[model samples]
Structures are given as structure tokens and as C-alpha cells.
Target chain A: MKVMMSLTVNGKLETIAVRPGATLLEVLREDLRLTGTKRGCDHGDCGACTVLVDGEPRLSCITLALQVRGRRVDTIEGLAREGYPHRLQEAFDREGAAQCGFCTPGVLLSAAALLAGNPHPTREEVRDGLAGNLCRCTGFQKIVDAVEAAARGEGDR
Target chain B: MDFLIEQPDTVEEAVRILAERPGAARAVWGGSDLVVEVRDGLSRPEVVVDLTRIRELVEVRETGDGGLSLGAGVPLEHLARRPELAERFGALAEALRAVGSVPLRFGSTLGGNLATASPAADSAPPLLVLEAEVEIAGPGGRRRPALADFFQGPRRTVLGPGEIITRILLPPPPPGARGTYLKFARRRALDLALVSVAALGWPDAEAASGVRFRLAAGAVAPTPLRLPAAEEILAAGRLDEETRTAVRRAVEAAVRPIDDVRAAATYRREMAGTLALRAVDRVLRTLEGGVA
Candidate 1:
């Protein structure tokens, strides 16, 4: 029951064969080999599979691949343009926001999703915005600071 | 368990697929809950009639009666920020905000929440208190039913084969009415409610009717319930200490809860009354020109 579906990933159109009930998370990690999105909880509880679908933060683990057929999907891999990291990424690096890095992709994308909608989010807003994502390393303070700095259009050297 | 999935861009196409293959087909909105079921082998839908592409099913429009008619696919993430909706429909806003997490909110739809029909569905009690009605579509066209009659039991609804919920219509609260939805949960995020309460009330001056009030409870019974017996007592009566105590008693007596992993029946019964009093007290304060 593999189905041919076209996905618009990282501004590129790619057609691939996927299982009938394959999730967007599976397609991103396996079929397409875009491993930036992690598989956490495999259910909707953890935001480790967070991705931007049409500029909104959505849980890719629960999203069907068919659901995003013609939609824009921005993953952690899509954060950089022309080989430079996204400002959010730079800010996180400069602030030492990532400890384990397992949660980085999801956290970065979740922050990017928030900054896209609210460019000047407060620190509290950044925390509230990324409440879905969990950092097992438990370095939330730095992550929130990184997001706030990114929202203010500040980046690392 | 392998199956074919169909994405119908239009309601007619979706309905046609469902009508022809009702047993094998299932309609999905957000897929937040349903995807887990399919992935876990709990339910293998031979054909998933994806309804997300039906454009008209996801828009939020102003109703003819000055209320809001939420397209079944309206995402909670988009609805929570509307200051007017949050201020006017506090209970629903709170309940919507209480759903899974921010990321889940972006994909989950209001219609999907109602269609799940879980006794603990966070959106049910809020909709019940707001006097919401739902529009169901099938091969025969559409039928609008009161939200009260929608639920049969846990994971069951009046929705027949080939029928899908298309929109939720909510009547405006009284001019001065204040509404609140409160739920007790294990955690602030990604947790199901242990017990939830929704209340809407207004003083005589702001109320279109005499001391209008409505009450509903969730996760403490077989289905989300409307406390008509309690509403009957609060609707026309003056706000008094004894009357408030009576309201709590009525709610406590009305709940038919059972022991579960989330809570014990005794605790749910007690919290039902506690939350009920708190929900009404907040509204009453607003009615008396005090802080809400």
C-alpha cells in the first residue's frame, strides 16, 4: 500500500513513495532522509517532532504525510539559507542553549515558529510559546534567552 | 492492516466515499488523536477520508445571530489569540488553551475535538456551557443538532455512518455575561483533565434574561453533562451565600464519576463542586463590578 506523494520540503518539491498511513515524521526521517526532526514519544505529547506547516508549529509525529502534500514544511534543515545558520540557531549557539542537542532541532524550529508570528516576543512569551518542546538536559533558561534574543533580531558573532 | 487513503478536497467527494464505504472509511480532521489510533493498530481504517482540504469546513465566521460559527476545522492555536473571543468566551478560550500543548493546538481542530466524544474531552464542557450547536453532513445534506444531544457515551456520538461534523455554532453570551472554564489536571501541559467545570452567568442588568446562568461538567461522568437542575436554581435567583452553596451541592449531586487512573470518584465529585463554585464566583465578581 505504498502511495506516491509529493512533498514540498525546504523549498524543494520531491516525490516519494510512502506507506498509506505513514506519518510526516516517518517520511521526513526515513523516506526523505531529513533527520533533523526527532521521533520523541511518537505520539503528540512531546514536541521533539515539531515542524512548521505553512508557518505554524505543528506536531509532525501525529501529522499524516498526505496532509502536507502541497503544503510548505520548514524543518530544522530548512533553517539555514546559503549555508548560514538561522539567526535563532546562531543565538542558541552563542548562548550555549543546547546541552544534549537531541532537542535542539525541535526547540530551534519551535522558537522559529514563535518568532515568525511574534517577532518581538518577551522572555515569558518565548517560554510560553515553546511550552510544547521539552529539553531533557533541562537548560530552559538559556533556550528562552536565545529565543528572546533571536526575536529582537540579535545574533551571535 | 494495510489500507488505501483518500484525500477528498471537497465535502461532496468525502461524503461520497464515506457513503459508499462507510465501514472501511473514516473522516479525519486534525488527526492528532486518530493518527495515534491508526499507528497503534487500535483502529485500522481501510480508507481515511481526509476532511482537512474542505475549505469551508475550517473558517470562523460571524453568525447571523451575532455569535461565532466555527468551521469544524478551525485550529485552537488560531482561535486562542482573538481578544474578543477570549474576553467574551473565557471558558472556551481557557479550555482551548488547556488542550495538549502549543504545537498540538496548531494542528488540532475544534470539530475534531468534539467528534472524539471523550468524556474528558476538554472542549465539551465549554461548548456545552456556551449553548453550542453542531452541523452534521451526510449523503442526505446537513442536519443541525444541539450539542446536548450529540454525545451518547464515551467515544460515541449521534453521528451516523457517513455523517461528519462540519461546524460548531455558538450563541453569544448575554451582554454582560461572564463565562469561565476550569479544569484540574496532573500537569499544566499534555495532561488530561481530572475534573473540569464550565459556568456562564450574568446579573439582571447585563443578562438578556433574568439572572441567566448555565453550567456543565466534564471528565467526571459518562458524558459531558449540562446541569439543568442547577441552572434552574441559579437562573432567576438573587446571588446569595446560601444560593451559592446550593449551586455547589447541586453540581456535586449531579456528577456520576468513577475511579480512574487520573482520579478517584470521590475526589472528582469533590473537585466538581469546588471548581463549580470557583467558576461561578469568578463570574459573580465580574457581575458585581469587582475584579474577575
Candidate 2:
């Protein structure tokens, strides 16, 4: 049975009706049309579906939409500010951090979560923090550089 | 994938719903494992009783006996934040820290790890060494099963259909005991354990009357298991080269491994001893915290 639930997604209030087993990834891409969050492996192994739920990076692929009923969920779509790119996004773009780009949104959000909690993270910390998201391109070094730059409050200037 | 998702606010209500539905109902927290199983058609429960909403299952309280009562729903991410808590249960912290990655850790619950009952579960070996007790709530009210008796097989546990784990009771490590969990994986991050070993030792006790050792192994057998034969030999007293080699051999012999996608059966058997020895040495060096 489909049920109605209210949730705060990317700063918007959404009262969406969804099947009981519908994942947060499904609702984000299909229902709300916010395709920023990509679905890689729906089994939670691939971090390509990563999103921020209550400020923590979580795999949306395995997260039931009903599970985040009244919680705040932030995705890659929420990272920009009034059409202005977020620093992490800017850093990734400037440093050529992304390659294939399928893993970019998830990696960016994971890094966003990292910077939000720890503004000046070490390189190793960045690697460990973003270990969930796999980037087959750029060899992960540039992604680490992008995250480190964002952590130091760089890329905007 | 169409099922009834009920978020019960209290333990009693959740238990009642589960009991009424029996095998048709299942409990979920974090849903990292269950949801995937549901999507893959590996498991089909009519009702998924969300345990996250139940307050009693999501807390981590220090026990009155200088131990810790880990709420089953406590996220693995919480372990990394509390360095103080990690220091106290070093092996468990190591195991959990090695669990998926940072993001998945935010969503993976300890209870889910145990209930999922994967043979390569990183968290189980440490709990085995810590002599943890599982607190379960079922139709009969509550029962605390020792960690040893908890596993029936892969993805199978002793938990009954209507029962949910409320908390896990872990008594503090021996006053001078050092704990260590060593995991070997094909990759460092987001991979299950190929072979892991968790061991605790009292150095002074070892020097005095052979050392008191509690050892457990993972991913090498049906479940994360405590090595009684190895423990008996190590407990017989002393960490001599002969004894160490004997312990390793005993562990290698004890495990019944199988050829899985992750590793070959022979390799798992070989690594089990190597990891076991490393875990023992690791605890010895815990008295020296990364200096070695």
C-alpha cells in the first residue's frame, strides 16, 4: 500500500505518496525529479547513491523513503547556493577531480559531509571519509585534492 | 516489494505486531542489509517492523558493572567519534572502523550486523573475544544469550521470529587486558573480511601463569568463532615460540573453510593461523600502542 509521508528534501517540504518498500533513491530520481543523486548499485554496496540524511552521508539505495519520514535529506542538488556552485563543486571542477562523472554527485556529497563536519581534514582522512564512494577515474588522488582544497576553504577565490 | 512498513514507538508494540504476524514480520534498523535482501528477492516479509523508532534500541549506556550496554540500533559511525570509548574496547573499535566506509557506517547498526549474520561480519570476532552477551526480547519477555550460542549459521541466528535484539552487554576488558582485532581483506575499504582474528590477553597473567588468552576468528568458517583449542593451549601458560606456533596450528586445524568468491578455502585456512598469531602479538603491543 502506498502511504503519504512528509519529508524535507533539499530544503523543500515534500508530501509524497510512496510504496512501503520504495527507496529514498527512487523517490529522489523518479518522484521529485531531482536526478542529482545517481543510483549505481541499489544494494548499498555502491556509494553512487549517497545522500545526506540529517547531515550524515548515507546510501540512499538501501534507505526506504518511509524511513526518513520527517527527517531532513540533502542531496547533490542541495549543495549549490542560488545557482552558485558550492566550494567542493568548484574545487572538483577546477582540479579536474571527476572523470566519468557518474560517481561525481555521490563523491561530492560525501566530501560535502566530510567538510561540514571537519573543515580542515588531512589527506588520509579525506581518503577514509570518501572511501565509500568509488571513483574509477582520476585515480582518487585528484578527488582527494579537491576535498582537501574544499576543507581548507579554497576554490572560491 | 509491496509490504506493510510499521514504525512502532515502543518495544512492546513492536513485539506484539511481530508476534501477531509471526514469520511474516521482520525487524529492521538502518536497513543496510535487510532492505538489500528485500530488493534482491532474497527475503520477503509482509511487514517490516522498523526498530529505529523504538527508543530503547538506539542508545549506548555504560553498564553499572563498569561495562557497556550497546543498544542494537547504535550506528557504527558513533564508534569512530568516541575515541575514549574506542580505547576501552580497542578490538571492537578496530573491527567497526573497518566495516564498510564512512557513509555506510552512518547507516549500519551493530544489531543489523549480527542479525544479518554474514560469515565475514567484521564486528562479530571482537564481540566473541569480549565475551559479549546478546540481550533479546521475544514472546517470553527477555533473554540474554552468550555470544557463543548466538549463531546458528550464515545469515542465521538463534533469534526467534518475533524476537528483536534490545541491547548487547559487554563487560569491560580485564583490568590489564589488551584487545586487538586484525582483519585481512582484498581491499582496505568497503570489503568484507577475507580472514580476521580478534584476541585479548593479560600480559602479566601470561608471564605469571601462561597468559590468559581469548581468541576468535572470522570469515574462515561457518561463523565468527572462539578458538577453544587454541585458547586452551595459550591459557595453559606462556607465550613461547613453541606455544605460539602450536596456537597457530590449532587455529588452522579448527577452522572448516570453503571456497567463496572472496577467497580460496586453502588460503583462508592458511591465513587464519597467520591472522591469529598477528592478533595475539597485536594485543601484546597494545601495551605499546602502535610503537611496534
Candidate 3:
């Protein structure tokens, strides 16, 4: 059975009809057409579908679409303000952190979440924060450097 | 995607819906595990009751007696960082952090973990050692059961029809007590435990062993088991090499490990003792003024 639910996505209120069993990932990409939130494992194992729910990083692949009703959801699309990219995105681009870009959205969102709580995270802390996100390319050294540089406010947009 | 979701504002309403629907309805917290089950066609419920909205059910509070009451809906992600909980129940905090990744913990709940009743549930061994009790709500009202007696087998518990775990009660740990939870998995990030151990010890000069210890292990048996045999060995006398060897043998004897995809039965049996000893050593070190 489909249910009508309302959730704030990317600072915008969206009222959509969704199946109860549909994951927040599905609703984000299909129903709302916010494809920035990638779906990787379709289970909780992979962090490819991570999103911030009420300011906390949560797995959207396992999160029921109706579960986030009336709650605030921040996807990769919302990580940036207006047309400017988020600091993490800018750092990723400058550091060449993304290889295939499939895991970029989830990785960037998780990095944003980590930095939101700890603005000046150490290299170790960045690795810990991004542990949930998997990157087949670059071996995460560049991603760690990118997050650390972003934390240091190196690349100002 | 074939079910309807019911978000109840209170426990009473949630219980009512569960009672009226029986097997047709199920209560979900975070939906990290249940959602996967539903998606995999392992469970096909007509309705899923989202219990996250019940404010009282997710709050972690201190009991009047200095103990703690954890609402079943409290997420592991939030609980792992709670300094108050970490101060008293350090083993539990460690176990919570040992579970999946940061994002997975955000959607995993203690109650949901207990409800799933997997033998490898990371929270079980610590809660077992902590002597926690579960508050279950059903059509017949509420009943509190010791966490030790809560499980029957894998994916099975004492939960009755329409019964939902509402809260977890943890007694205050002894002053100066030290504990540790150690998990052995294929990979630390997102792998289930092949064998896990939890140990909590407190100094007691009057006791025969000169200390009191609580030991438990996971994934090696049908349920998370309290190591009474190992505890008995440890209580026999001083913490000598012979005593430690006996404790290892006791743990190996107590666990009923089986060959599974993640591990072999013989290997689990051996590591169960190894981790149990390591956990005990860490606890002893902390109790004796050494760093954990």
C-alpha cells in the first residue's frame, strides 16, 4: 500500500506518495528525482546510500521512506548552497578524490556529516568518519587528504 | 513495498495496534535490520509500526537508584557516544560501537537488536554481563525478564504475540569496576562477529578469587551465553596461570559453535577461549590501575 508522506529534503518541503516498503534511497532517486543519493549495496553494509537525517548520518538504503516523514533530510544535492559546491566537494575536485564518482555523493555527505560535528577532525578522525564509505579507486588517501584540507579551510570558494 | 506504515505517537497506541493486528503488524525501530528482511522477502508484514516517534520510548534516563533505563528506540549511534552511559556501562558502550559502521548504528536500536535475537548480536554479550533486564509490552500488559533468559535460539525469544520490547534496565555497576567487549570479525568495518567476548570485573578482597567477574560470549552458541563455567573457574582461587588455563577450557567447553560460512566450528571454539582470556586480561589490567 502506498502512503502520502511529507519530508523536508534539501531545505524544501516535499509531499509525495510512496510505498511503505520503499527505501528512502528509492524515494530520493525515483519519487523526488534527487539522484544525488546513490544506491550501492541496497543494504546496510555499504555506505553508498548515506544521508543526513536531522543532522545525523544514517543509511538511507535500509531506512524506510515513511520513516523520515516530517524530518529533515540532507542529500548531496543539499550539501552545497545555491550554485556553489560544498567545501568537501570543492576539496574533492581539487584533490582529485573522486575516481568513478559513483561513491562521491555518499562519501561527500558522510564527510560533511563528520565535519559538521567536528570541524577540525584529524587525519585519523577523517579516516574513521569515512570508514563507512568505500572507494575502490584512490585507496582513500586522496579522500582523506581532501577532507583534511577542507577541515583546514585550505580551498576557499 | 507492499505494506502500510503506522507511526504511533504513544506506546499504548502502538501496543493496541500490535494487539489488534497480531501477526499482521510489526513494530520497527530504525528499520536497519527489519527493512532488509522485508526487502529480501524474508518477512512480509501487512503493516510496519514505526516506533521512533514515541519520545518516551527513545529517551535514555537515569533511574532513581542510580541505574539507567534505556528506551528500546534509542539508537546505537546515539548511545555509543553518551558519556553518562559510557561511564558506568563501558562494556555496553564498547559493544555498541563494535556494531556495524557509523551510519548503520544510527538506525540500529538495542531493542531491535534484542528482538532480532541473533546469536551474534554484539549488544547481547555486554548486556548479558551487565545483568540487564528487558521490559516487554504486550496485550497482557508488561513483564520484565532478565536479559540472560530472554533468548531461546537464533531469531527466537520469549516475546509473545503482539509483545514488543519497550525498555532495557541496567543496574548500576560497582564502583571502580572495569570491563571490556572484544569482537573478532573478518573485517572491522561491516562484518558480523565470528566470535565475541565480554568481561566485567570488580575487586572484592573478601571473595575467594579476590575479585568478581562476569563473562559472556557471542556467535559460538545458539544464544549469547553467560560463562558460568568460566566464572566458576575464575572464582576458584587466585588469577594464576593454571586458573586462566582452566577458564579457557571452561569457555571452550561451554560454547556450542558450529561450522558456518564465516567460521569453522573448531576455530570458533578455540577463539572463544582466546578472546575470553584476552578480555579478562584487559579487565584485570584496568582493575589493577593499568590502562585498558
Please report the candidate that would top lDDT against the real structure.
3
What C-alpha lDDT values do all the predictions have?
Answer: 0.85, 0.87, 0.89
Model 2 C-alpha lDDT per residue in residues B1-292, reported as the tens digit of each score: 7788999998889999999998789888777888888888988999999887888987888887778999888889986577655778888988888999988899988888998888889989999999999999988899999989999898899999688888988997887777888899989899989899999876443344445778999998888899989988877766788887898789999998889788999999999999898887777766643222
Q: Estimate each model's TM-score.
A: 0.94, 0.96, 0.97
lDDT of 2 by residue, A88-140 (tens): 99999988998889999999989988888888988888999999998787899
Candidate 3 Cα lDDT to native? 0.89
TM-score of 2: 0.96
Q: How far does residue B135 in candidate 1 sit from its true spot (Å)?
A: 0.5
**Model 1, residue B240: C-alpha shift (Å):** 3.9
* Candidate 2 CAPRI assessment class: high
The sequence of per-residue lDDT tens digits that candidate 3 reaches over residues B103-136 is: 8888889999999999999999999998999999
Give the top-scoring candidate (TM-score): 3
Candidate 2 DockQ, CA atoms: 0.88
Winner of 1 and 3 under lDDT: 3
**What is the C-alpha DockQ of each candidate?**
0.67, 0.88, 0.77
Candidate 1 runs further than 4 Å off: B205-210, B236-238, B288-292
